[model samples]
Target chain A: MKSDSDILTTIAVQFAIMSFLALGGANAVAPEIHRLTVEVHGWLTDRQFADMFAIAQAAPGPNVMIVTLIGFHVAGMWGAVVATLAMCGPTAVLALYLARTWDRFKDAQWRVAVQGGLVPISVGLIGASAIVLARAASHNWSAVAITAITAAFAYWTRWNPLWLICAAAVAGLAGLV
Target chain B: MPEPVSPPAPAAPIPSHAELFFAFFKITLSGFGGTLPWTRRMFVEEKRWMTDNEFNNVYALCQFLPGPNIVNLTTVFGSRMRGPTGAMAAWAGFLLLPFCMMIAVGLLYERYGDVDVARRLLSGIAPAAAGLIVATVAKMATPMFARFGPAPFVIVGTAFAIGVMRWPLLWVLAALVPVSIALTWWRRR
Candidate 1:
C-alpha cells in the first residue's frame, strides 16, 4: 500500500484538538468525530461509523476507542495508534497536573461555575451525537425497534448494555433484522 | 471551603507503581460494560486503598475535568497514590489491553467485515449501539430538564444546532459555552 503521511497527521491533529472537547467523555465528542470522518474527509461510510461504534462499545475500555477504529480505517494500524495516543495523551497530562491543585480550590466559586456551565453543553453535545448515530443506524424497522428497545432499557432499567448488544447480534444472525 | 478538613488517614499502605499498574490492568479485564463499578470495588472495597468518600470525590473531580471520565479517574488516582510515574504506570496498564484488543478487532473487521455473517451481525448491533447513545443522552438530560432553568435551553440549543443543523462543533461550542457560562455565572454570582 502506498503510504500517506498526511492521513496520519490529520488523524493526530483532529483528535488531539477534540481531546479537550470531550467534556462529558468520548460520547460528547462523537458528533464531531462523526462529522470529521464521515462528512469532511469521507474516511468511513455512515454505516461503518455506526458499526465501529458498536464494536468499540462492545469491547472493553474507554468510549474514545472509537477514535482508534476510525484511525484504523483511515490509515491502518499506525492510524489506530496515533489516534489513540493523540486523543488520550495530552488529556492524561492535564489530569496529572490538575489532580494536585484542583483539590485546594474545590469550592472556589469560579470552579463551581465552570463545572456547572460545561455540564449542559456536554450533555447537549452527546445528545447531538445520539441523533447523528441514530440517523445512521436506523434505516429499517428491525433496526428502529432495536434502537428504541435498547434506549428504553438503558434509560429505565440498569441492565448491562452488553446483553442488549448481544441480543441484537443474535437477531441479525438469525436474519431477523 | 474549610480546606476539606484534614485529609483522612491512610487506610492501607500506599500503592507502589507496580501495584497501581496491576490494579488498573485488573479493572480493564473485568470492565465488560464499564469500569466504574470495578474501579470502585478495587480501590475502595477490595484494596481498601481509598475511602468511599475519597473515591467519590476523585470520581467527581475526574468527571468535572475534561477527557474520558474513567480514564481521568485512573490518572487522578495513580497520581494521588504515588506521583507522575505512578500516573504513567496506571495509564499504560489501563490502556494496554484495550488497545491491543481493539487493534485486533479492527484488523478482523478489515479482513472479513464484508462477509455476510459479519455484516448481518454488525447491522443488528449498530442500531442497538445507537440506542445506547440515545439512552445515555436521556440520562444526562433528564436531571437538567427537571431543574427548569436555563440549562434545558442550553441542552436543546446545543442538540439542535449540531444534530439537526449540522453546524461545526467548535463554532457551536464557541458560540454557546461562554454564553451558557455567563448566564450561569451571572445568575449564581
Candidate 2:
C-alpha cells in the first residue's frame, strides 16, 4: 500500500526533472521517458510506449498529451494529473519569468553563445529520441522497410504526416509491412 | 532595418482574462497535428493581438526556455496580457480539454490494447511515429550544420553516447553542455 504512494511521488519527481531537461521540447526527452518507464520501473512495455506516442501525435491536441497518457497507465487519474502538471508547470513558470526579462539581455554576447551551443545539443538529444523510438518500433525487416519509406517521404515531401500514419495502418490491416 | 527614432506607440490594448482564456481554449480545440502554426494564425492574423515580428520574438524566447515551445508560448502570451492570473487561465484553457481527451484515449487503450486487431493497428502506427521523429530531426539538423564545426561534433557525440552506448542522459548532458557552451564562447571570442 505504501509502495503505491511512493510510486506516485516518484512519477511526479521524474517528470518534474524531465520538464527542465526538455531543452528542445518534450519530444527531446522521449528516450529518457522510455527508459525510466519501460526499463527501470517496469511501468509499461515497448509496444505500449510506442503506441502512446503514436496516439499522442495522432490526437487533435498537443503531443505532450503522451505524458498524461503514460501517467494514466501507471497510476490512474491522480497519476495523470500529477504527471501533466510536473511536465509543464515548472517550465511554464520559468518561461513566464524569463520572457519578462529577456529584452534586457537580447544583445548580450554570452546569451547568443548559449543559444548557439544549445541548438546542437537540443538536436542531438532529439536525434537520440528518434533512434530510441526507431529501435523500439522496428524489429523485423518488413517493419524496417515501413520506417525507412515513411521517413523518406517525411524528409523529402511536404505531405501531411497524418496520411502516412493512415497508410501504415492500412498496410497493417492488409497484412503487409 | 533601422527604424526612425520615434517614441513607440502606446501598448496594444490588453486582452481581458476571459478573452485570453477563451482564445487559447479555441486554439487548443482546433489545433490538429500541431499547435504552433495555429497559434501564430490566431495571434497574428486573426486576432491581431501581436504582430508577426512580435510573435516571432516571443516564440524565440519560448524556444530558448526548457519545455514544450507551445506551452511556454501560452504562458508568455497570457502573462503579457493579464499577469499571473492570465497565465493560469491560458494554461488551463490550453491543457484542460486535451488532458481530458488523452485520459479518454488512455482508458480506451487500456481496455482494448491487447486485442489482436488493436495490437496490429498500433504496430503499424509505431513505425510511422518513428519515421516522423526522424523527419523532424533531419529538418532541424540541416540548419545546425549549415555552417558546421563544433555543432556536428556536439550532435554526433551526444547521439552516439545516448543512442549507442545507452548512457544515462543526466550525466551526458551534465558533462557535455558545459563543453559545448565553452566551445561556442571561445569561438565567439
Candidate 3:
C-alpha cells in the first residue's frame, strides 16, 4: 500500500501540472482530471466523479470546488488541502506578479497577439469539457435531452441556471430521467 | 446656455484588510450559481472599490492568466488594494468557507451518496451541470467568433483533437499556440 505522504504527493504533482494546463479554467481540465483520477488511478468511478462534479456545481463559490471534492475523495482532508493549494497556488502567484506589471504592457503588440490566440484555445478547451461531462452524465435518451435542453436555455435565455438544476432534480425524483 | 457643472463624486475609502476579507467572504456566500456577476456587483456597485472600466480591465487580465479566472481576480484585486497581505486575506476569505463546505459535502457523500434517492438526485444534476459547461462555451464564442478571424479555425481544430480524437492536450497546445500566434501576428500586419 502507498503511504499517506505518497498519495498527497501524487495529488500535489498531478494537480500542479493541471493548474498551468487548465487554460480555460477548472472546467477545461475536467476531461484530463477524469482521466487521471477515474481511469488512470482508479481512485473514483465514473459515476462517483460525475456525482462529485454535480455536487460542486450545486455548491456556492467557484467552479474549482470540484478539485477539492476529488482531492478529498482520493486522499482525505490533507489531499483536499494539497490539491487545492497546488491547483491554485502557482496561478495565484502569477497573477500577483502580473498585476504589478501587466498594465504597462497592455498595449504591446505581442501581448495583444497572445490574448488573441489564447481566446479560441480557451473556448475549445471548455467545449472539450462539455463533451467529456456529457459522455459521463448522459447514459440515457432522457438524460441526453435534459442536457440539450439545459444547454439551450443557458445559451439563449437569462434565467437563473439554478432553476434548471432544481427542475432536473425534480425530474429525477419523479423517475423521468 | 452653459450646462451646470455636476458635483464631485465622493471619494471611496480604501478597504482595510479585515474589510477585504469579510467582503470576499460575503461575496462567496451570495454567489450561488456563479461568482463572476457577484464579483462585479460587489466591487463596482456595492463597494465602489472599482469603477466599471477598471473592473473590466482587471477581469480581462485575470482571464488571460492561468487557473480559475475568479480566483486570479481575487488575488489581483486584493494585491492592488493592499499588497500581498491583503491578497492573502482575500484569497483566504474567498476559499476557506467554500473549502469547509466542500469537505462537509465529501463526508456526506461518503456516508449516503450511494442511497437510491441521492443517486437519483445526482443523476439528474449531472446532466444539468454538463449542460452548464456547454452553455459557457457558447456564451464565450459569440462575441469573438461573430467577427471573421482565425478563432473559428483554432476553436474547431482544438476541440476536434482533444474532444474527438482524445489526443494529449499538451501536444495539441504546443502545436497550436505558436501557429495561432504567428497567424494572428501575420493577419494584423
Q: How would the docking of model 1 be graded?
A: medium
Extract clashing residue pairs from model 1: none
Candidate lDDT (C-alpha), each: 0.86, 0.86, 0.87
Q: Estimate, for each residue in A61-174, the C-alpha lDDT of model 3 and write its tens digit.
A: 888989999999889999999989998888998889988898899889998898888878889888888898998898999999999999999899998889989999989888
Clashes of each: 0, 0, 0
**Candidate 2 on B21-64: residue-level lDDT in tens?**
88888988888757888898887777777777777789877875
TM-scores for all candidates? 0.95, 0.94, 0.96
Better of 1 and 3 by DockQ: 1
Score candidate 2 by DockQ: 0.76
What tens-digit string does per-residue lDDT give for candidate 1 at B72-150?
8898888888888888898988998888889899999999999999999998898888899999889988878988678
Model 3 DockQ, alpha carbons vs. true complex: 0.79
Better of 1 and 2 by DockQ: 1
Error of 1 at B149 (Å): 1.3
Per-residue lDDT of model 3, residues B2-50, tens digit only: 3423223324798999999998999899988888899888888788787
C-alpha RMSD over true interface residues, each candidate: 1.1, 1.2, 1.0
Q: For candidate 1 chain B, which ten residues in a row score worst on lDDT?
A: B1-10
Q: Is candidate 1 or candidate 3 better by TM-score?
A: 3
